[model samples]
Target: MVVNTGLYAFNVTCAHRQITPTVNSIYGDATPPNTPADFEIKVASPSFTRRFFRPQVSFYCDQHSPFKPLPLAQAYALLEWGMNWCIATHDHTRLLVHAAVLVKNNQAIIFPAAPGSGKSTLTAYLAMSGWNLYSDEMAIIDLESGFVSPLYRPVCLKNNSIDLVKQWFPESVFTSTWKDTHKGDVAHLKASSWKQYIQCKPTEIVAVIFPKFVANSDLKIYSLDQLQAFETLSKNAFNYGVLGNLGFKMVDKIIKRAALFEIEFGELCDVQAFLSEDIIR
Candidate 1:
């Protein structure tokens, strides 16, 4: 089967048609029944029944192994993530930052942080509340328009956050947990709808936030100057260096248009309240 992720299309062939029900349900239609793309994926067998590994790749799984079983839902999450990496790493002419994006009132806010920085957790919380989730792992900025385009893919939720979000919004949809992976227990939240994917819009970014989850830390929002924001954003970007001078122009436009900040918090509620009162207002 093949899938098109809006930005790029992929062709995936799995040994078993019933390997991942969730993946099939969401991406089954994406299989290139007509068009063509350079990106493609081929799954040898059902992850539950096969022992597999690729060259230079360290992870492998088998049916009888003690490793925790990865549910079908989680399989789709893994697939999407791998595809994103492929696109970002190979397409080096655009600015691709590891960030989560949420839009309000036609304005977008980007949160760029390293792993374990509570970026995804906060994104999930705000998305479930009211914000439009653009993406959870990537913020794709258009060089010409100076606007951020939405990538409506799954939101990767990790470890304790999986259960925390479940309790917070019991009605929210989540993929099955893929236990014992590199990032501990992992799952994916389908935060944005399919309609958003089809009707994507370019949004002007109004704010850039770098979030850090500190236990017992008071909720603090500090202003970030344009120079600092530019440096930080460039470092977090996946393709800034690849774009060369064009990348510099894109980054300059973003910083000039957006207000930047660094937020430190331990509670999602406090962060949400601040965003509602300060940023959105």
Candidate 2:
């Protein structure tokens, strides 16, 4: 099956039949016929006997299997992760950052946070609240224009965040949680529809926010200097070293134009209020 996610087309062969419903639910009516896929991938049993024994699924991008075989239950999740890996590893035309891209009123902000920072949760909230979710996992920045483009993908929530998001937005569509993965209790939230994704265009980045979630704390916003922001962003980038001079120049340009800040907050609403009233205005 060819899953066309507006930004990239993935030709996926799923040997695990159970993974199909989750894929279909998340991406409905987005498939385009005869469209050449950007990556040819598959999620199948690692070995002949494994299919009948323990039942593990392996993600293969063409001839290479980037990840080890996971349990059959995580086939869809593995496929999603594999797709992200394919883009980050293969695509060099754009400067890709390991960040969540969210846009409002044509102003885009890239949240480049480490794991356990509640980045995904914040992204899910903003996306559901009305902000255009460009890409939940990556910021597709144009090297020349320094603008960020949207990718058709779901926001991945893990552990406690899964229930928190479900409680916040009960009507939102979510995939079945795959328990005991590398990232424990993981689920993917469909924050925006395909129509919203197609309407999104590359927009100039207005801010670079590094958010950290603190338990039961007031909003703390710290301004980051250009040098600090540049260094941190470079480290967070997937292909900074690979892109070399081009990547350096692109990061420099973005820092020059974008307001850089570190935000530590306990509540998503507080962060949203601060951004909407102060930064994005």
TM-score (all chains, Cα) for each model: 0.84, 0.98
Error of 1 at 107 (Å): 0.2
lDDT of 2 at 117: 95
> Which tens-of-lDDT digit does each residue in 203-242 have in candidate 2?
9999999999999999999999999999999999999999
- For candidate 1, write residues 140-165 as lDDT tens digits: 88878878878757788899999999
**Decoy 1 TM-score against native:** 0.84
Indicate the worst ten consecutive residues by lDDT in candidate 2: 27-36
Worst 10-residue stretch by lDDT in candidate 1? 55-64
What lDDT, from 0 to 1, does candidate 1 have? 0.75
**Candidate 1: regions farther than 4 A off:** 16-18, 25-35, 45-77
Best prediction by TM-score: 2
